[model samples]
Target chain A: MDSIYIHIILLALIIISSIFAVSYARVIRGAIILGIVSMLVSISLFLLSCPLAGIFELSVCSGLITVIFISVISLTLPPDEKQRKVNSVSMMKKMVLLVLLVLVCGFSLYMLDSKNITFVPLMQNVQESIDTRDNIWNLRHVDLIGQALILLTGLFAVVVLFKKDKNKDKK
Target chain B: MSVENILLFKLYIIATPVLFLVGIYAIMTTRNIIATIIGIEIMTKGVTLLLASCGYFNGRPEMAQSFIIIMIVVEVVILTISAGLIFNIVKKHDSLDTRNIRNLKG
Candidate 1:
């Protein structure tokens, strides 16, 4: 119960920071910050008592996504140079969209408030005392093997499909 | 207003979507391909956050957390591969800008 307020504050921080990421002049920096925001969200989940999702968000998401972002594109652009290229119309469009998004999010929160779904105790009335034995949060052997297979296959597919760029001269 | 009872709903229902919106805005507005990928990552995290919140509120943490784990794994593989591909492209062309990419579109 005392925790809800903390979560609320965290939530506010998440939104504000994301807005900063959106508006930042440095796109790569923004992406890096956005990854931090995701980590915050993961933390917020754990605070709310959702450990599984929290771990996922924290371990796999926070760093992995940044690697993806950093990997996919070089982050050497100057902010002002990029800023000069961004037209006012595009910025205005993003602002307008953000406003609408906020409204919808607010409305959904209101709807959740209309219902009384709080105070949920852990494993309230399940026949499955199995909840204790359930290490759903922990990754296991078969899981790792399955994942390894998937990644290996995906790599193979990429190799088979790598086509050389046919046109190196549109600049 | 008991602080504990505050529902913390705004973070999920509000903040989550806002994060997603901002992420989208970043993706759409940025010409830097890496930044755009970051935007996509932000939005994906926003979604996972919302799911975890829902699972928390409903006392079904496993459902949300497991999904998040799976999502994260998939995203990492895809992201790594794509990053390598994008890097390879840039190295061959000397820039990561979209216009340069379009020129290589043949």
Candidate 2:
């Protein structure tokens, strides 16, 4: 019971931080807030008994992603102050409606009766001996290959996109 | 099966969509290209949570963990590519506002 409450609180924090993340005017601040959301998510994952996922979420999403966002933000020119204010004002108006809709949906979901819905029974014969590492390396080797392929593709794409064109420079 | 498990499941089910909505709203409402990416990241986080919770409830935490690890790797690569694109966009337009690049020029 206590743990459920903690989960609820963690989720609430996640939502709130996410809201702040999008609503902030400064892009860097929004990135930082997104990091907070990721951190909360990792905590929730831990509570859900998935420590490996939690650790990955913590390191990758909260740490690496935030760093990526900050570096991108630094590379981009900041918007003019006047335009930022205008954008924020309009965003706030839309955000209010969004919040109201989200609240109603949350309430309805809360009121929903779980007994009416049937969930798959937990697996009774899960192999305890096969750990996550072994599962990834053995059973899910295809996904590993795909990840490696995508990463290589992304690396080449980034290099090409960021490379300066000498002909365009001369022109 | 357990009451705690059911409650946790319900919580995740509710939270996931809300995160999705927030992310979509951010994507649709923001003029900044980077904000769009941020929104996408939020949605990704929601998906991660859903996957983790489902893994826990389905009694396959190891499988879920492996999926998440792969997901994280993919997400980082995607983010890096997008960042590179945004850097180039900023160079071309000199501003982060999407309004400045509304017209696609050949």
Candidate 3:
């Protein structure tokens, strides 16, 4: 019973923080709110019996991603104040409508008969105590290789994108 | 499954789609490029929740956790590359507005 309540609270926090994340006028504030959303998600993952994923999310999404966003925001110039004010007013109006839509959707889904829905049957022959580490290192080695290759590609991309072009500088 | 598990699953079903909607609306309504990326991140979060819940209910938490870990790695790489792109875009345009990039001459 308490677990259900905790999940509900976490869901509400995720939704509210996500709303604020997109609605904030300042990008920095939005980035910070996004971090909060990620944190809540990590907690929810933990509750859902996914401690490893939760740890990764907490460290990568909530910590690394937020820092990356902040650094990007710092590198760029701020938007014009007058333009931002105009945009914010219109955005607020849209946000109100969005909130209404979400409420309606939530109510309708709540009233839904989920019992009618079918899901995959639990695999009885599978090992009940398999470790996530073993699953990743042994069962999902291809994904690990893919991750490494993609990381290398991303590193090269960043280096090329940020490198100063000497010819352009001379021109 | 227990009553509590079913309730948790229901909560995930309802909340995941709501998060996706918010993300889509953000991407649609915002003109800033960074905000678009943020919207994408939000949508990814929804997907993560869905995957986690599905794994939990399916008795395959290990599989789901591995997938999520791989997903996080891919997401980080994508984000880093996008950040680099945004950096260059800002350097050339002097603004973060997506409208400025409408004219693409290869």
Candidate 4:
């Protein structure tokens, strides 16, 4: 019961941070806010009983992705030139749409009658009682192989691209 | 299913869609390509949340976790390549605003 409340609060924080991230005028600021959103959402995922995913999200999304974005933004534009032109009318329209969607979600949740909602003990109900480690090693081994392949591809691509850029610079 | 689980599930249900919309809004409203990439990242997170939540609901957290792991790897790769492309575009066009790059128009 207490934990559920914590989950709700975290979820709310996630939504708020994302909204701020998207709406902020400065691109770097938006990127930073989006990083905050990822951190909050990862915490929320932990509260919802997905600890592994939450930890990965925190490390990868919040940490690596945010750093990548900040570095890219800084590399491309000077700190003094932080402001980027935005379409105000479209921004307003999107905000309005987002507000409406949020309202509808709240209204629907209200109408759904929380008292009737039910849940099962997800971990306990599993007949196999397989450990998460086993699940990864035994059941999803193929994904692990794929993960290695993609990471190598990414590293190679980054190296090749940066190499090309360096050659261009010298020329 | 416990009450806590359902509550969490419902919360995710409400939140993920909003995240998706906000991501799209971010992409559409921002003139800078980098900002649009930020929006794409947000949308990817939302989808990951949805996927993990559904897996948790079905008592298959490992399945979701495994897939999300793969997803994160792929996402970073995509973002890296795209950032390079964006940098190249800036060099060629001198601007990150999508409107200024009209060379693609037929």
Candidate 5:
């Protein structure tokens, strides 16, 4: 028997909504909806015994979503200049591209369906230096902290870069 | 719904890459920066789903869950910073479409 059915449903809901949210999200409200979906999914993961992921997901997805949504939404709300050219070709191109993409994705999904979908649980992507499977909990903390710091630094650099470029544009 | 089967967790590993790839394709082809960020999020989310499923399959939760947590952090940060930059670019250049931003035509 499965450990939790409702969580699975919630995850499924999150995944499906995420895909739709991506496709249909034109404005800020739609994006917020998708971000909300991510938050709910994170909560579900926590309920399934993954508190670490749950906490970050809530922080990123929920914590930043409201402000980000409002800001992004407000940024493009009213065009100050009537510089919009209204290109019709771009819309047609996007529609055609979307159809082709759907076809390809459908075919790929079909192909994967016929095969044995489950892998051998060989832990393919995991780094193998930590050989002991049973005792990984205590071991990963140090590495996680280091990688996390590096990641934070990288994010800071990116923001500074963006700020620099925007200032350059102003000049 | 078929994911309810006992073997579905196992299958999630295979499905994960496809989801990630498709999401990337969406991101690359779409010109909208927001859509692109959403695409990147999808790809990362697929990886998390894959890792979580793998852990569930093998009955190991610690490592996978931890990575998922890290990914969530990075995703949020990247999404905000990039989105903010794109918004700034759009405002300054007067175009939400990214293709038109290249003013250096050398």
Candidate 6:
């Protein structure tokens, strides 16, 4: 009730992993970092009391998406580019970047404090809190159907695009 | 609101813009198509966090949860399809560099 250290820690981890995911040159390494980011984000969401979303994010993004990205990376990446070792120079650059991020965050928080900014939560007068499952099934069933349709369409498109041509004998 | 909740909210609010910028920077600077996709995923993460925090603040966890679920599903599907398309392009062009795929007049 007072403070949640785990939330902060997970959020910090997510931030670091996200930065690395975008900055890393190697697709495999970036994908792995993105997975880490997703896992940390899911944990943070769970800590924030959104367990269902967290679970979906954990299982889907961290698990499913990471696998897809890694598979694609392996398939498309050049074999010769597979084995680049991270030397001291790149490590130094990362260290410097990390320090810069910390400084920027500190400065921004300081500025926020000086500005006397306050966050106002919206929708403060909702009379009742509904069950998430009920909300999904009853109120949002239409959106649920849309999501299913989208998932099916995407799956179909990918399968069609990747299917091996049986008509190669024509050549 | 409790101190932890407020702190969490602030952290996410600050994080959203920072991560968004990082994602944009990655997209702009990276030459590799896969890296660009990674950047897009990072951007989506930023937006998702922002949405979740808004839901938390509004005390509408269910609404937020549903949106997040929908977002995650859509993001994964988009990423998969884009990755497949990128793979196809790479097979045709023999290069993952975006600049190499420029001449599409045929």
Best by lDDT: 3
**Pick by DockQ: which candidate is best?**
2
lDDT of 5 by residue, A25-100 (tens): 3546557766777676676656545666667667777667546765776776433333323411256666776687
Order of quality (DockQ): 2, 3, 6, 4, 1, 5
Lowest lDDT sum, 10 consecutive residues, model 3 chain B, at B2-11
- Predictions ranked by lDDT, top down? 3, 2, 6, 4, 1, 5
Measured against the true two-chain complex, the DockQ scores of the candidates, in the order shown, are 0.42, 0.67, 0.65, 0.48, 0.36, 0.51
Please report how far candidate 4 places residue B23 from its true position, in Å: 0.6
> Each candidate's root-mean-square deviation in Å?
5.4, 2.9, 2.8, 4.2, 5.1, 4.5
lDDT of each: 0.65, 0.84, 0.86, 0.75, 0.62, 0.78
Q: After superposition, which runs of candidate 2 have C-alpha atoms over 4 Å from their true positions?
A: A85-115, A121-129
Segments of candidate 1 deviating more than 4 angstroms: A67-90, A96-150, A157-171, B1-6, B99-106
* TM-score of structure candidate 5: 0.71
Error of 2 at B61 (Å): 0.8
Pairs in steric clash, model 6: none
lDDT of 4 by residue, A1-171 (tens): 346677667777877888788777677898888889889878766755678878888998899988988888877853234334333436567678667766876777677555554543455534364666777777778877887888788788777666655666788
Q: TM-score of each model's B chain?
A: 0.85, 0.92, 0.94, 0.90, 0.80, 0.88
Please state the error at residue A132 of candidate 3 in Å. 1.1
**Candidates 1 and 5: which is better by DockQ?**
1
lDDT of 1: 0.65
lDDT of 3 by residue, A34-134 (tens): 99999999998898789999999999999999999999999888888976764453756677867877787767676664454446467555577689998
Rate residue B104 of model 3 by lDDT: 83
Candidate 3 residue A170 C-alpha distance from true site, Å: 2.3
Question: Per-residue CA lDDT of candidate 1, range B1-106, in tens?
Answer: 2434334654366567767777777766666666666677778777877777676666565655655666677677777666665666566655555545665344
Choose 2 or 5, whichever is better by lDDT. 2
Better candidate by DockQ, 2 or 4: 2
